[model samples]
Target chain A: MMHLLKIEWLKIKNYKAFLFISLFFLIGIFATNYIVYSVFHNIVNKSDAALLLSNFNPYDFEHVWQTVSYTSGYLLMLPSLLLIILVTNEYTFRTNRQNIIDGSSREEYANVKMMMALIVAATSTLFVVLTALAFAYSSEKDFSITGFSHVGYFFLKALSYNIIAIFISTLIKRTGFAIGIFFIYMGAENIIAQFLDVLSMKLKSSKNIDFGSLGDYLPMNSSDGLLSFPPTPLKSFTTSSLPTEYTWIVLGFAIFYLVLFSWLSRRLIIKKDL
Target chain B: MNVLSINNISKNYGKVTALQNVSFSVPRGSVFGILGPNGSGKTTLLGIIMDVLKATGGTYKLFDENPDNQLRKRIGTLLETPNFYHYLSAVQNLKITAGIKQRGENDIERVLEIVSLTNRKNSTFSTYSLGMKQRLAIAAALLGDPEVLVLDEPTNGLDPVGIAEIRELIKLLASQGKTIIMASHMLDEVEKVCSHVAILKYGELITFGNVDEIFINDDIVEVASSNIDQLKDALNLMPGNLKVEIKGNIVQITFPVGSANLENVNQFCFEKGIVLSQLQIRKKSLESKFMELTN
Candidate 1:
C-alpha cells in the first residue's frame, strides 16, 4: 500500500499544473476569508445583503467551524480541478496506455490514481478545516469551541465530494471535457432546472420547491446543494445540519458515487487499449 | 516443455473480428517472433496471453498455468510504449509497479542501471528522449527478472543505434534462457533475433516453425550449362531431388541448404552428356523467406 502511494506520488510529482492548482487551493482559503470578512465588516460594502452579513463572523472560532462546513461546497473545487487533471490527463498524455502495457493492470492503475486523489481530497479537506480553525481563533482570542459532534458530519460530507470528483474525472478521462462538465454540474446546468422552476412560478402554477431534485443528474447540484441547506449564518450559533437524518441521504449518495465509480473504473480499465 | 500454448484463441469487437482462431506456441527458452502487417492482431494476441485482453474464442496457458494465475509475475511484457505517470522518474515508476506486484525488493536502481537510465534517474519522464523512454520500458519489464518477456514493437521509433542496443539486450536476455515473444513487421530485425518465427496475415497464423527448418530447406543454387535442354533433363534425374527452374542457359535450383552437390551433379550430367558452364551456390535471405510465408 505504501509502495503504491510512493508510485502515485512519483507520478504526480512532475506535473507543474498540480503544484499550481494546489497553491491556488491554498490561496482560495484566504480568498474565502476575504469574501466573508468583507461581507461582515461593512468596509465598502455595496449590497444590502452584505450589510446584513456585517455582524456575522466567518472568521470567529465558533463561527469558523460553521463557515468551514458551509464553505466545503466551495473548497471542493480544489480537488475537483486537480482530479480532472489527475485522471483525465492520463489518457491525453498517453501515459495510461503505456502504464497498462508496462504490466500494471488497468484497474491497478485506476485504483492507485484514485488513491492519490483520495490523498489530495483528504489534505484539501484538511486545509479547509485547519484554515477555518485558524481564522476562528484569530477572530476570537477566547473562542470557546463546542459542537464537536458535527466534525464527523464535516468529514463525511467532505469525503463524499472528493470521491465524486475522482469518479467524474475517471469516467470522462479528458481534462477539458471533465473540467467543463464539472463546472456545469457545479453551477450552470442547474440554471436550466432553475429556469424551469421559474416558468412554473410566473404561471403561479402548483410546483414543489423541492425541484432541486433535478440537479442530481448534474452531479454537483444534487450533491453539494444538498449540503447548502439549513443556512450556515443563521444556524452559526448551533449546528442543526448535524444529526439531521436528511443529511444522511446526501452523505449516502456521495458514498455511493465513490463506491460505484471505484467498481466501474476498475472494470473498464482492464479492457482499455493501452 | 511448451512454455505457451494457444488453443484456437479468437476475439471479435462487435462487428470486426480482431483475431480469428489464432493458434501457436512458444517452446521454453526460445526467441519467438510474431510477424504481421498492421492490423494483423499481433498485439491483440499478445494482449490475450497477458490477459490485457479477453479473447473471444480461444484459450492460452503460460508456464502451465491459466492466464489469471499468479504466475503472471513470472512474465514481464512491454506491449506498447511503456506506461507510467509521466511526472515520475524511471525508478519511481518501476517502484510503483513493484508495489502493485507485491514484490518488495528494491531492484529499481539496478534495472535503471541495466537500461542505462541511471544517469537520468532523477529526471522526470517528460525530459527523457523517446529512446530513453523505450529503454526505461524495457528496464521495467526486466525488473522482476521474469522467465519470459513479451514485447510489441519494442524497437519502434528508436534510432538505429538505439534499436541495435535494444536488440542486443533482447538477444542477451534470450541467451540467459528467457522465452522472449516479440512482435514486429520489421522482418530483418525479427529474422536476426528469433529462433522461431510465426507469420500472421490478416489475423491468421499463416505459418509457424523453427527458423532453421522453414528457411534452411529453401537455399538457392544457380547453375548454367552449355546445353540448357540437356542440363534440365540431367537435373531432373539428379539424386538430391532438388527443385530446378531453367531460365535460358542458366538454371536455378533450390534444395536443402548446405547439401553436398554439383560434383555428384557433374557426374550425373557428364554421364547424361550434359556439359556444365557454371555452377554456384547461394543462400536465401530472411526477407525472401518472410515473403514466401506471408505473401
Candidate 2:
C-alpha cells in the first residue's frame, strides 16, 4: 500500500497543474466557508431576526463545529473535481497502460487511486477541522467542547463524493466529458429525488397512507443526510433530522454508495484492455 | 530453458479478431524477433504476453511460472511506443517505474548510464526527440537487470544512427545473456539482430525456427558471358537438377540448398568456349523470403 502511495505521489509531485488546482480548490473551499461564516456571525447576529431565534448560537463552540461541518459539505464538489482530473489524467496520458506493463497489477493500480481518494478525503477533512477550530475558539474563549462524530461524518461525506468522482472518471475515461456528465448526474439525481418526494407527499395527504420519503435514499442525498444544519432564523421552518429509525438506514445507504463506487472503479480498471 | 511459452493464444476486440491461436516460445539468451506486416498481430501478441491486454482465449507462461505481478517483475517490456509521463523528467518517470517494480531507487542512475541518457536525465520527456524517447524507454526496461526484455517495434521511429544504436544495444544485452523478444516490421532489422524468428500473417503463425534453418542456404548464381547463346547452352548441361533460366544476357541458375558448385559451372563454360563476363552468387534476401511467406 505504501509503494502504491509512493507511485501516486511520484506521478503528481512535479505536476504543476495538480498542485495548483488542488490547492486552489481546497483553499477556495476554505475561503468561501470563511467568508460565509463572517457574513452570518458579524452581520446577521445584530439583525431583527436574531431576537426571534435567540436560542440559535452560531458562535458557541458546539454550534461552531456543526456550522462549519454543514457548510463545508457544500464545497465537496471542488475536491471532487481534483480527484476526477487526477484519475482521468492517467487515461489521457496513457500512463496507466505503461504502469501495468512495468509490473504493477491491475488491482494495485486501482488501489493507488483508492489511496489517493483516502488522502484527498483526509486532507479536505483536516481543512474542515481547522476551520472549525479557528471559528470555535475565536467565537468564545470559555466555551465548552462537544463530541466530534459529526466532523467524522463530514469526512465520510467528502470521501463519498470523491469516490463517486473516481467512478465517473473510470467509466468515462475523459476529463471534459466526465466532469460534464457528473454535473448533469448531480442535478438529475436531485430532480428525481424531489419528484419522488412530491409523489410520497400526495400519497400521504390523500389516502392517509404513510409511505416514507424516497429522497433521503438517493446516491447524493444519502451522504448529505449524514449531517444536518443547526436551526437558524432562516431555516427554522424546516425539519432537522430524519426519524430516529431511519438515521441508521441513511448512514447504511451512504456507506453502500461509497463501497459500490469504489468496487465499480476497481472492476473497470481490472477488466479494461488498457 | 525457455523464457516464454505461449499456447493457443487468441484475442478479439468485439468483432475484430486481432490474434487467433498463436503459439511460440523464446529460448533463454536468444534474441527472438516477431516479424510480420502491419496489423499482423505482432503487437497484440506482445501486449497479451505483457499483461497489458487480456487474451480472449488460451494461456501463456513466463519463466515457466503462471503469469502474475511477481512473474512480470522479472521481465521488462515496452509495447508500441515509449509511454512515460510527458510532464515529468526522465529521472522522475523512472522513479515511478522503479517504485512499481519495488526495486532500489539507486538503480535509476545505472540504467540512465546504460542508455547514455545521463546527460539529459533531468529533462522532461515531452522535450525529447523521438529517438531520445525510444532510448529512455529502453533505459526503463533495463532497470532491475531482469532476465528477459520484451520490446514491440523498438526501432519504429528513428534516424539511421538511432537505429544502429538500438540494434547495438539489443546485441549488447543479448551478449550479456539476457533474453529479448522483439517485434518489428523491418525485415532487415530482424535479419541483422535476431537469432530466431516467428512470422505472423493476419493473426496466424506462418513459420518459426532458427535463422539458418528457416533461411536455408538457397544461393542464386548469376552467370553472364560474352556469348549469351553459348552461356545458356553451357548452363543447361550443368548437373544436380538446377533450375536454369535466361534473363536478357545473364543465365540465372538456382541450385538446391547447399549445392552451389561455382567451380564446376566455370569449368563447363570455359571448355565450351564461352568467356564468362560476370559470375556472382547472391544470397536469398529476407525481403523476398518474407513476401513469399506472407503473400
- Quote each prediction's TM-score: 0.84, 0.92
Question: How many Å off is the CA of A229 in candidate 2?
Answer: 2.2
Tens-digit per-residue lDDT, B67-172, candidate 1: 5535666677787666767777776777766755556247888888877889998887778888888888888778777788888899977888888888998899
Superposition error at A216 for model 2 (Å): 2.9
lDDT of 1 at B219: 60
For residues A1-274, write the lDDT of model 1, one tens digit per residue.
5755776676677678889988887888778766776665555345565554555455565556656656655666776678777778777766665555445565667667667756776676677667777766666446656543344455555555566666677678788888887777656656875764445444433432332233343334435534442244545654422222245555566567667766666666665544
| Colliding pairs, model 1 | A40-A54, A61-A136, A98-B83, A99-B83, B9-B58
Residue lDDT tens for model 2, B95-211: 998988887378889988877789999999999998889888988888888889998898767788878988998999999999999999998889899999999999999999897
The prediction achieving the highest lDDT against the true structure is 2
lDDT of 2 by residue, A1-274 (tens): 8878878888888988788877886677678768877777677767876787774566467777677788888888888888888888888878888888888999988988988888898988888888778777776546655746778878888899999999999999999999998899999998998887777676666765544566768888888877777667766454432222266787889899999999999999999788
Looking at chain B only, the TM-scores across the models are 0.87, 0.92
| lDDT accuracy of residue A185 in candidate 2 | 95
